[model samples]
Target: MSDATRPRLKVLAAMSGGVDSAVAAARAAEAGHDVTGVHLALSANPKSFRTGARGCCTVEDSHDARRAADVIGIPFYVWDLAERFRRDVVEDFVAEYAAGRTPNPCLRCNEKIKFAALLDKALALGFDAVCTGHYAQVVTRPDGSRELHRAADMAKDQSYVLGVLDDRQLAHAMFPLGDTETTKEEIRAEAAARGLFVAKKPDSHDICFIADGDTQGFLAKHLGTAEGDIVDEAGAKLGTHSGAYGFTIGQRKGLRLGNPAGDGTPRYVLDISPVENTVTVGPAASLDIHALTAINPRWCGTTPAAPGPYTAQLRAHGSETPVTARLDGGELHVAFDQPVRGVAPGQAVVLYDGTRVVGSATIATTQRSTPGPSGA
Candidate 1:
């Protein structure tokens, strides 16, 4: 197709009734592409006042998205994805906690619900691509491969949560906010200037499906109470915990220990044993790890011929540390360049090569090579 005659892309903007998504739809429409606004209904039991206009799946949000679509002169629709979201993201989150792992629900929602399920549905409906407000960029390399990169706004970079998307998804995706130099405040101001309904909306913080940020309470309510013993590294009973699902790696507070160590130091949760219904506490040093194993890996762009050295990020805003990552029997093994702390299993480990996202996996286990100090 010639440059001018190239078919105008039919894009579906996943609006969440937020300033970011609102501006994204505006920008897409201004670019002359055929645009549609879609608000995903991922919550079935909505009780919050901010449901539609504030959270990801409120009726107010649907109306706001529809308003944005009308303002941009595009067709708008709401897709009920609650069943899939609950099954793939929420249930998996509970299961991960029950297994003593810390799950990143946002990453799960992006991988399973948004990109995988929503993308399929959009494509089946004849949309050329699915666009969103994700603060990430897709670049076409000289070799003609699509590469995922960090957005210009470092503080708002969302590549970590998007690291699991493969090339097929990347091919049919648009991130309109990727190149925008606007901050959240600026976006909100722009929305106000445009008289948008979500101009004064507060940002969503807690998990959308969960009523509150009480993760432990939510897990207990869903998975049933499994009270367990809180022990030290040597398997000495320190105290009793309410449940194994309540604790995560590197957590320091809420142990409820009546006494301190002999050195007057604090203890941290180092491991959780779901099988034994126990949580292991030790000095902060025990949280240090030099290597980790990850299962169910997904490589964006293209898979490396052989895994070598790369920088791995353990958290969304966490520092990128040097590590040697290799694919072993469909799994990923990452050996840190140095001992790193707070290497929690169940969190995402995203790998990168400079600005390009290499791939990512969920941390399954860690192997520590050095013993930590005593009574630390």
Candidate 2:
């Protein structure tokens, strides 16, 4: 479509009071589109705590976003999304941990809160698209389907976390930072040049709802601690754990096992059985898995053909490995081309075709495949 024939789009930019989001709003306004800035208040009561210049959804963050919006000559608003964020992201994170799974709150926030809920609200308000500072791209294929691709900056690429977005959501999404071959420093420089207040602010990490980086502490405080038994793979009692939620697959430290292995080698957590109130330990090699099962799979577009080999990453920063994936019933079965270590349940398995994200699903279980005899 020619620029003259195209609609004069109204874009809603989700500003997080960061340099990246500030630059994103600026870029959107410079693109000749009517732009508005929105800051989602995800915390239950943001006014209770003094806002910091570096945190997300803080009172100071709202102020920073408002300043950016003013500089960009766009209207600004703060939407109270605390209730939805609690139910969709925070509560789900706690529930997943209570069930002995390590959940990614960022992914859940993007899937349920930002892209799904916020996108719906923007569309209802007559906005043509919603933009964010996420470092991922939306490309239109020859078939007119929108494909999610990695950002130009590999270190800041966020495609894995955004793999849950479906095609329709991608169609109405904008990522101005995706095409920029600039680093965080450069973005901050641009913001500083524009005299934006958040130019020098540090990035926020960890679960946003959790005050500190204490996942176990947060779980214990909310869910209450459940003492459990730590045992060997054969179900023989080896030690006692403070809580099952505190442990994860392949964790070798903090076991506090009173007994050592027969070979005097340190053992690792191979599995956690919540029903049995036990954490199984064995040789570290036992953490290797050749195959895994995942449920609630969501593809970027339609489901791809089964029995196709693709690249899969177990975690956001994890290395991508070739795998053969197939849909079985309602679950996804994936067999790695090579053995992978520490394949934990509850982590996301993101599938990709080169730089394009295909889909992602939560890992349900992992199993070790029997090896062939030597010299076969």
Candidate 3:
């Protein structure tokens, strides 16, 4: 579309002190949007600088974001969302782990903080849309509805984490990087060409709140010590653990089981019972799950015309398995075409039809086929 025909928008670009966001903000300005950059102060007591690529939300990160805004010649401001982040993301993470369930905080941030909280405020304050550097595409359908699709760069696609967004939230979301069929290297180069300070900044990885990647230690500090017995499926005691919440399904490491499996096979964590304070360990075959039930389903667009085939992803960066899904009694029941391993409860199971995100839900439970005499 030419500039004469293009509609000018009052855009709020969420800058995360990364090259991607810097370039995104630049692109928004280049497109003639009345863009303003905002950096989210998620960490209350941020360190002086980021340690490696483990975390963002540091003092230096905010400075970098500000410098990027200056390079882009846009108005910049920092929004303090530390308390909200603690309540919504950090505390929720601990609570989920305490309940013997795995939770993805990035997904929660997108659901609660970014789209729900930030977007609501942005729209109310007269902004037409909330732009970000998330690697996901939003397509405006011919019927004037918006559809969320995978990024052109498959390696950097982030639609899985963004599956939490509903159609209404997606309507006012802009992702400049999603439209380009380029890589992260090109984004940084663009930032360099634009004279942005974060051109050489490393991409942030790991959880933002957890400065060190010690999830077990972080949980131990918050939930405290709840001593539990680790046992096999037949209730045979294998060892003991500091807490049942410290382990996840299909985990084989850190169990410290004194005895090896009777048949000399590797043992993995099969289940975690917080109420009983027990962690169940079994052979690898026990991890194969055939069906899973997801609760509190949220569709990005609409419910399927009929129950049929769709690709379901259990984890971010996990394999997509073809499954037949149906919504019954407010729950999404998915039967995988093939047995999938490491299906964890409390994780978001996103459903996709081709590139478009159909819906998502929290995995409440999984059903596995019985192990046979010869194993799974």
Candidate 4:
């Protein structure tokens, strides 16, 4: 489209000092948007440099982001959102672990910080939309309603973490990376061609707050320790542990069992009871779940016209399993056609109709179809 015909927007490009964000910001500018790059300072005390791909939000990252903005010829600024991130993401993660639940901090960051806090601030500053490098598409329908869809590169699609964004947020969101048909390698190549400094920067994989990638140590430092027991299906004590919050469902390692089962079968953690301070272990069969309940559901679009079939995803990169979902009151109930394993509470359960994200909620509890053996 010509500049005369294309819609010009005052856009805020959220630069994460990564190659993807740099390329995305460049694309936004090329598309005729009056883009301004803003790197978010999420860490209270950021390190001077980043060590490998351990975490994000270091001072070095901010430098890279600023340089990218310079190359793109857009005004750059650093927004200090450390306090908000600590309150919303870090505190929530610690509390969820303390309650014997596994929470995904990335989803919370998108929901509360990036789209909510940052977007709100951007609008107040006269920006029409907050553009990011996330690999997810926002499509405008014929009726002018926006829908969030998976990126062209399925392997790199980030729609799961963005499932919490409601319709309102979707209206003011722009994903330049999602509009591309290329892969991360190609994006990095484009950045290098454009003389961006972050062209070869490593991708960050660990949680931002847990810099050392030691979730257990982080939680132990924040929430302290509570002695707990490792028991079998029959409540027969197999071992002891220092904390119940340290363990998660479907975990097989770090159990430190004093004695192996009589049948000599491998054991996996099936449940974690914070109140009882116990970790329940059993055979792999016990991990099979037929139904699950999720709390605090957030739908991206309007409520489903009717309860029906929808693919449910448990993890960000995990396979989408066929299931039926029904929302009651404020909770979501999902029934799987086949048994699903390794589902943990406090994890976000995202529902999708094909590649388009419908909504998501936090897993509260799961139900089994048939009870396993008493001592299994």
Per lDDT, the best of the predicted structures is 4
For model 3, where is the 10-residue window of minimal lDDT? 1-10
Q: In candidate 1, how many clashes are counted?
A: 5
How well does each candidate superpose onto the true structure, as a TM-score? 0.93, 0.93, 0.96, 0.96
lDDT of each: 0.82, 0.83, 0.87, 0.88
Tens digit per residue, CA lDDT, model 1, 225-246:
8678888778788889878999
* Model 2 root-mean-square deviation: 3.7
The residue-by-residue lDDT of candidate 4 on 1-376, one tens digit each, is 2111237899999999988888889998998999999999998798922567877889989999999999999999999999999899999999999888999999999999999999999999999989899999888776777788888788889999999999999988888888567977898899999999999999988787787888898888998888888898888888898889899989999999978888999999988888899999998888999999999998888877678999988998898999999988888999999999999889999999988899999998888765743321
Off by over 4 Å in 2: 1-8, 47-55, 370-376
Arrange candidates, best lDDT first: 4, 3, 2, 1
Backbone clashes counted, model 2: 0
TM-score pick, better of 1 and 3: 3
